[model samples]
Target: MTEHKPEKKVCVFCGSSFGVDPNFSKSASELGVLLSNNNYGLVYGGGTTGLMGCVAKAVASNGSYVHGIIPEALVSKERKNLDEIKKMNEELKESVENHRGATPLDDSYGKTTIVPDMHTRKRMMAQEADGFVAMPGGFGTLEEVMEITTWSQLGIHAKPIVLFNIDHFYDEFIGFLGNCVAKGFISPENGTIISVATTPEEVISKLQSYKVPEGRFNLSWKNQ
Candidate 1:
């Protein structure tokens, strides 16, 4: 008997609205296609708006798996994207025949899992992903990536985390992390848990080769 290995998924954190820079959206789409071509599935906040939707659509259209975790509070806002994906998949199913073990369009182009609240949505996203990527985004994107990195620091999970520094978007944030390390708020070793990648190709490469940094503390509730 052969064993079945599960597909690997990378959770992407990005803006719900397209930023002023055209390159931001361009990078998001490129990353999505790159992820698909590399045989990695996508896990993301279920928004069809901005960079979030751009990446998700690219991945889906490229015949890759896209699992979106959305909170109920924001479902009304993001529902349109889901609908668009479904319609697009339906059209593809009608026009194309299955080849190369592709999933049937009627079956599922991708899926959206709606949770009751933000916490649940975030928890589910974290649980589902094998790695993490942060694109140019607002506060939500920042919070999501940082929380995941903090989880890595706490020994909760050692998954790879990369910051997609599109057009040097994350330069200031990277400097902030450095300042924290310099101030001793964050150890230099711990600082390496989050990596910086300026290009989508670099993002994939880093995720593939990432190693958990030294000095990670294992927390035990029993001791607490």
Candidate 2:
């Protein structure tokens, strides 16, 4: 009898806003399409705005499932586009009304499944995903990526961390990693935890090539 392997789910972290570059949005949409076509589910911040919405909508439009975890307090603050939110609300309302029985207009749009904050979101993403992919984003994206990388570094996780370095957005960050190695913050040998690629295809390929070691590393800071 042949063994069946479990399907892998990838967690993607990106900006709620499209940023200054159009390339960022293009790359995100491309990733969403690729993930859907490949039968991979998406887990991301729940926002019907900016690149987050673009990716989620693209995947959903392709009939793929997406899991969104968002913090309640930042729903308005982190929202990318107010206009898009209203549109999504209307669509969601219609879908619900068609499938389910009629509901109150106030309750038309379902409540967001919100986490406490960014920290909670990061933990959830790491716990739920087989691996992580970071798209072009701002501080929030960086924080999520760094936390995932740290988890791997501390031997808490063995998942691959891939950086979609589209449009050379992460060039300076990559250079800073080199500086970390030089300053003894991170060993050059252990730097393989992060894989950099210019496109979604390359990102998936790089992640697939990663193999967790049979024995985990001792990650005690005191010992180090």
Candidate 3:
């Protein structure tokens, strides 16, 4: 008899909003489908709108499990679409009516379980996922990705942190990391903490091959 390996769950951090570009949303949906087809579960924020919702919807439609973590206060607020912000009040009213009685937007549009708060959400997702992938997002997304990267650098965790650097959104950030290496604030070798990819297919390939090294380091060198 042959034994089968369990499907690994991946934590994906991405923008709640779709932004101005259609490519971002398209890529997000593609990633969801890929994860589902590969038997991978998704761990993400709980919302029924934006890029978050798009990814969640794709996974659920493909019959995969999704785990969503969100702060309690932001649950209702986060459900509103980002583009809705630019609309006139009258236009917003008309837009809401147009989509009325449509799919009852729920966390499970992608078959998800929602958690509350940032701390709890991060902890749970970190614990549950076999790896992590970060798509383009704003400040909140950057914070989440940084936290995971820090954890990996400290040897507190051993999961891959893949960056979906769509549209060169992360180009400047990558440059800043280089500056850190040059200034002696971080070891150039620590740069291995993340893998950057321009496409969803590359992101998956990087995650599958990532391996974290053993041991943690102190910042004594920084002081010296």
Candidate 4:
């Protein structure tokens, strides 16, 4: 059996809105299940709506740890979703009780931390996670993904970063990245930092097989 790295956690960046495509949400939930089955914890933007909620619920229901980091400003907005997640977890536990042959569920409905600001939320998330995955999302998700990728470029960390391209959502971005390499904006070697995965299984596989790209640029305090 492949040894699972239970200590490693993945931070997912995605929208709070359930996008038009059903697959986006479906993929998010599937990713959650995959993470739980593989014994990997999840760290994500603390929210109960859209992809975030779907993924969080799946992980918690499947008896895995989930850490949600949210800015104080958005906690109120996510309260309803939080309540729903709690209810769903409770129901799942009740259902599990009827099946003695099944494994017992953990008391991990997941916890949410409210930070003062977005910067603090992101910093805490980055500190908590060993890797990152970008799902279909809007500007906020894109920014988070780019910032983390930039951190890798500066050698802040060499953790694997993956783009979950469900329904070809990230096709344009991937093309844009290739264009960057072709245009000499980002070198071909460095462009390999952001990996692309089409399915949840592929995402986990790529993450496990990932290696930090060698001969990449490094930043120094003196340079900054």
CA lDDT, every model vs. true structure? 0.78, 0.68, 0.71, 0.78
Where model 3 places Cα greater than 4 Å from the true spot, the runs are: 1-6, 77-108, 111-116, 213-224
For 2-119, candidate 1 gives per-residue lDDT tens digits of 2113278999998877889999999999998899888888988766667877888888878888877655454333233555544453222221111112112222335666566888
**Is 2 or 3 the stronger prediction by TM-score?**
3
Ranking by TM-score: 1, 4, 3, 2
Model 1 misplaced regions, further than 4 Å: 1-6, 77-109, 220-224
Candidate 2 positional error at 203, Å? 1.4
* Cα lDDT of model 2 by residue, 1-224, tens digit: 12122276678888767778888888888888787777777777766556776777666666666666654445434344435645553222111111122211112111234566767766776787888899887777898889878777778888888899989999999999989989988887666678899987888687788765443465654422
Tell me the tens digit of each residue's lDDT in model 3 across 45-87.
6565667778877777777777665544343343454244234
Cα shift from native, residue 83, model 2 (Å): 24
Residue 188 shift from truth in candidate 3, angstroms: 1.7
Q: Poorest 10 consecutive residues of model 2 by lDDT? A: 91-100
Q: What range of 10 consecutive residues in model 3 has the weakest lDDT sum?
A: 89-98
